[model samples]
Target: MEHNLSKHISGKFNQDLENVRNHVLAMGGLVEQQLNSALDAVSANDSEQARQVEKDDYKVNAMEVSIDEECTRIIAKRQPAASDLRLVVAIAKTIADLERIGDEARRIAQVALDSFSKEQQDLLVMIDNMGRQVSKMLHDVLDAFARMDVEAAFKVHKEDAKVDREYEALIRQIMTYMMEDPRSIPKIMALVWSVRSLERIGDRCQNIAEYVIYFVKGKDIRHISQEDIEKDILKL
Candidate 1:
């Protein structure tokens, strides 16, 4: 959790950096709340709660724009170098992913607003379980980002594969459901899209994990395999 921000001579500069970092964490907290509420709506089948989640998405979007502007202002005014630059860059990227995660959460919430049959409810249960997995991943990655913990980031990075496996299995089961009951196609399509959104959220969490690694290690590890990350980056 400790960083080099205080090493700077100007106390104002240190405060500037600290302010931006805290804002990112606050934004992360809001995004986490949004995801949790969306999952709750799905599990409870509450259209009112789902609509509330939909309404709250604008808050997440606003935070992204505000943080982005702050980062730009820091770069222009402070002209930071080395680790400071990386921190700002990583944070800018992190907020973008978090906003997308918020969007996906809203999409997942939309599922509760639609009517599902008993069999479809079973599929939704599976989707809810998968969403819980992704939500945990998002939670862990955000914790990693807050601490600038590379090991924690790596751990969360590894969890995405489990989400992907669950996604594939659910897709197979859902596709079978669609093929057997063509009458349910319309509603089932919505479920399929929601599951897909959950999968995308998993990917975004992984991307944020990568940003954490980049910030701590000063390495751009995108498109690198997990084995390569552990072998080439993590070990160093």
Candidate 2:
């Protein structure tokens, strides 16, 4: 038998869905703060700042858990359809991306702690720039989501190129250092992890941006290569 909700229950269900949206936005803010603090710690060479980043990791983790629980409750109790269902699904996915970004920030802090002596200013500069790019991507994607702006989301998808180029540059430098001085291999490896973590943060940001597009248009803009999206879809 198909279950039918009474009018009052349906209204309450809609309210519950809105709560999920709010919770997702809250989680996005927390992760973005962590990313900013991680960059600040790296740039400033402040151990105390790095420690603060580590401490804030729990807040992000908690947000992830809470959002996940809310999503489960909505799906079970509300059985929302159409856009409401889409919103809940998007919120769940966005929280996952934000949580992953938080994990990457924590990883960066750990890399800094392990790799820094007094300070590695050159490496710190690169990491700060990388974090900044990732932060901007996340911020714009979140804005795109709140507004349901597909164009803004697509822009984020394109902006990922800068992060990719930076990651490749870091890889080259790492390989060169390893080849020239075998003694630097251990430190170079640490740098490699830090840089890769930053790049993965960018990827998670892109993933969230795509979610905005999907929720708005219900398109699986993912897995469709850039060329296809531009030449195939946009052209049509």
Best by TM-score: 1
Give the range of the ten consecutive residues with the poorest summed lDDT in model 2. Answer: 1-10
For residues 81-173, write the lDDT of model 1, one tens digit per residue.
877888889889999998999999999899889877776789988988998898899889888887778888999899999999999999999
Given candidate 2, what's the lDDT at residue 69?
94
Which regions in candidate 1 have their CA more than 4 angstroms from the true location? Answer: 1-12
**Candidate 2 global Cα RMSD:** 5.5
lDDT of 2 by residue, 33-104 (tens): 888887777676667878888988999899889889989988887787766677778888989889989988
Whole-model Cα lDDT of every candidate shown, in order: 0.88, 0.77
Q: List TM-score per model, in order.
A: 0.95, 0.87
Best by lDDT: 1
Q: What CA RMSD would candidate 1 show?
A: 1.8
